[model samples]
Target: MSSLTHTTTPANTPVERKATRSAGRRTSPNALLSKGVVNALLIVAAFYTLMPVSWLLFAATKSDRDLFSTSGFALGDFNLFANLHHVFTFNDGIYLRWFGNSILYSVVGSAASTFLCIATGYAFDTYDFKGKEKLFAAVLGGVLVPTTVIQLPMYLLATKVGIVNTYWALLLPALVNPFGVYLARVFSEGYVPNEVLEAARVDGAGELRIFAGISLPMLAPGFMTIFLFSFTASWNNFFGALVMLNDEKLYPVNLGLFMWNSVTQQQPEYYSLVITGSLVAVVPLIVAFVCLQRFWRSGLTAGAVK
Candidate 1:
């Protein structure tokens, strides 16, 4: 029995050592140290990104005097309600008008932009039109060009068309998003199967019917993505609005807040209003993302799959 046991132990010793080494590697101090470092970096990044938002939130609760005097992260007197009342009441409630205009611009403009992008992209994906690639390349080049650079040209064109300083001025330019077209084309290629389209054609479905009845449902996620992108872009657009709008009534929330911020240079009392209004301005965007998070996530995942 002793001789048999000795032989078995010798044979199993190497296997036991190998298993121990693997287990050690998996739970090694170095591996754990690296993981700790990665977690730390992620935390730092999150903190950095959230810091300004946090400061804004805290600042909004303070009075004008407290805004500058109080510690940035510390809460001052709870005057959020008062500040909101002041914001709505100030300048005969022009801020509310600005907010309403922003809503109209973002919702209507983004919907238009999304529809145009999807139609254009679908055409590119499915049709064999002349100059399709060249036209698409031009659109792609537009994406690389900064909006600031084109703003002057667009302003000039708007002047030629006599649409400057009007609702059309903001909405029309917002609708021409090159990147949205690119994304929509990618989504069309991935999500819309050519076989399905061919089958629809075989069934005598018109092009419009195929798109509306079949393709739209499959492209719902993509539509949501493009809408969100366009909405955010339109809502936060300041420079274009600044250039196009001389009328205070036409100003979006961003520009409205900027106007108030500018005034704070002379009248320090406007400081609290600016902070509070800024916080209020951010709420719609947050609400949009939260409400559509499920659709947004699914769309992003579907797009990434291909």
Candidate 2:
């Protein structure tokens, strides 16, 4: 007994060291492969989306001879100005009219529609009305229905009401986007806290006053999101415009370009004009996005966390 010395070693020490080492090197080949695949898909998608726009940029700068003669991506003679002059002057400067029409439809329609959607969404969220969820479910169902499905019906109704072939035909339908309503409802739930609304109401604020003062300020991000969506949709409303308006004066920039492009089969000169018009048509959207993208992104992020 005197000759033996007791010794004890902790068994868990070795195991803990092993686990630490493994944790430090835990990145797996499968995860790396998945990341690589996702990156590759994103690159492919970006290329597909930008390819046409890149072609338009190059094509817009070329003259008729250069456009057909050179490669689609090749630099052409610097004829952007000449092309633009021709585009503006052709048909008594009708391009300007189209631009103006687009501004009116996009700006005014978006403003009204965004407010309407926001108000409806706020009501759905804050107030406990009968059939509210059912009504909202119906609106969601409307979003699944393709817009083209309703186009003909909307056109017929507009015709019956004598608003077809006018700005009202396109403008009115844009104010009724079910998707916008859904988006607004989601945004309201996220951004506009019920506690704030209740506090305002308890302070003797009327419902309209509460919405206008407290709720509306909180819902700014949603407003901008809906406005941009509505504006872009109205700006590119080619099919609806085609069905409703025969007058070139009422054409939006997109439809105007389409009409010009249709003539390129017989008249090659229209190619440069159409390309240039298309490039110009893209400017408003770019500007709107640049100015408002942060709001949209913030809204989305806020909604996600909520």
Number of the top-ranking candidate, with TM-score as the measure: 2
**All candidates' lDDT scores?**
0.91, 0.89
lDDT of 2 by residue, 35-151 (tens): 899999999999998898888889888878888889999978988888889889999999999999999999999899999999999899899978989999999999999888888
**Candidate 2 accuracy as lDDT:** 0.89
Residue range with the least summed lDDT across 10 consecutive positions in model 1? 1-10
> What does candidate 2 score on TM?
0.91
User: What digit string (tens of lDDT, one per residue) describes model 1 on residues 17-42?
Assistant: 99989999999999999999999999
On lDDT, the leading prediction is: 1
In model 2, where do residues sit more than 4 Å from their true spots? Answer: 1-26
TM-score of each: 0.89, 0.91
After superposition on all CA atoms, what RMSD does each candidate show versus the true structure?
A: 3.5, 3.1
- Please give the RMSD of candidate 2 to the true structure: 3.1
> What does the lDDT read for residue 239 in candidate 2?
88
